[model samples]
Target: MAKAFASQGDLAEKKVSFTEVGRDLWAFTAEGDPNTGVIIGDDSVMVVDAQATPRLAGKVIENIRTVTDKPIKHVVLSHYHAVRVLGASAYGASEIVMSEKARSMVAERGQEDWDSEFGRFPRLFQGHESIPGLTWPTLTFNDRLTLYLGKRRVDLMFLGRAHTAGDIVAHVPDENVMFTGDIVEYHSACYCGDGHFTDWPATLEAIRCFDLAAIAPGRGDALVGEKLVNEALDNTADFVRSTYRPVARVAQGGGSLKEAWDACRTVCDPKFSNYAIYEHCLPFNVARAYDESLGIDTPRIWTAERDLQMWEALQG
Candidate 1:
């Protein structure tokens, strides 16, 4: 059975609006769904985080057509996830960019992650057949890279690991706006299956340091102004704390995965139960917490088979 939070009723995917944050920076966001951002320059355009597949990305491109006609010269992958990067080929982007760490992750466990995520959420991958293959970045940097879009400055920074080891954020310095892939989510579950729990809090702090006039979060509506920005950061922080602490506590007591899952339901369900994908994320979150509680620093790779095993082990 497809697992979903009690709070998330029948959520059907739909078209989103393209909100302009700055002169040429805009964000396309669906209702509590993964977002795709566009950065238009004097000469070319850059796409941030492609949707699940080429068919789904066509919707994003259609939205882009309403804005500018510039060819998409660059496609930036925030991390190596099938949902985030698999649709790059659809854009016909001349250059695909990523952090070196992200590329390494693609080589290590990219296929496994693709299977796991596809198995978990089929709705996100609307046009499943449109997936060309795994997306590989043509250009990669270590920590940071500054790309000059004509006169516009778009900085891609790998501040720290939260969502994944290769997670990076797109910061348009001129606009004081940052597109946080999954590092910061507004009213959405923090999918921490590949996350760095110990380092995630610190990563949020780094994101907070930016002079953010507006923020395009991984899911939900975009946040504008400092007040909303602060709210996003706070909510994200609270969700992470609520997810990790209780599971860690339960695991430390020699609790089984089911015990930890139940504990999470009691604590996190009340607080973040309304967030997007909460039900789908809880079991994986608890499993990671259990591992972390035992002094495991890195999260275990989530294969599709492992996902089912964990779900069966905890759900029953």
Candidate 2:
């Protein structure tokens, strides 16, 4: 059976919907589940982010088959997250692309993240044993890489650090569309556990510079119009601010992590009550916010033990 989760208890289960945003641009979204964007070029194809596992991504590839028969040439990792990049090998893409910073993050904490995420979201990692190992990018760049899928131009650029140091957005100029992987999510909880909260808003602003008519966000539904795209970015920016402010204030006041978490809950839970993953993201979000508020530059690795300890601290 296909498992599902409810968002707002109004949007139907398995919130997966595909909207053709432009010529050969399709957004595969599942009710605020991690979205996979597809760009079909004349000669080949490029997938924005692989799903959580080969089984999950194979389903996406099956969808691509419905659109075109050309081989999938590239699978891009927007950042090093188990849910995003683990299914990369399934695409059989000759070139798996990522930012150099993201590659480093994979080298440093990918394994831990894999374990951590598997624990947090067992449903996403349904076929866990099938994951060969940490998915490594064959091609990495500092800022950007442009590919010509026949005559179509797909520019992958690392505008700034947001979700992770190596976050990148895939821009399709002719389509006036951008695939923002977790950099911007509409009506969903922003996972700041491994994020750069201070840099996230600026990154969102940088994304606004593009005259994009549509966007395929990492989660939530595909933003099909300029109005919806702006709303996604603005809502994401507001969520980031709401996440950081209360935690920072409490931390700066010399309050305990628990106190900071309480302050954050009081503010966020009320407004973002309907967002997906609110319960799952809050503890990690507050922990990262507290760390940033205390001048911690890089996010700490989250092991199973650390996750439990943090949960207990917050629950108590």
Each prediction's TM-score versus the true structure: 0.95, 0.95
How many residue pairs collide in each prediction? 0, 3
TM-score of 1: 0.95
Identify the runs in model 2 with alpha carbons over 4 angstroms from their true place: 1-13
Look at candidate 1 and tell me the lDDT of residue 150: 91
Residue pairs with colliding backbones in model 1 are none
Clashing residue pairs, candidate 2? 15-30, 15-31, 16-30
lDDT of 1: 0.85
Candidate 2, 88-119: lDDT as tens digits: 98999999999999999999999999888877
Error of 2 at 128 (Å): 1.3
Best by lDDT: 2
For each candidate in the order shown, give its overall lDDT on alpha carbons: 0.85, 0.88
- RMSD in Å for model 1: 2.1
Error of 1 at 5 (Å): 10
Off by over 4 Å in 1: 1-11
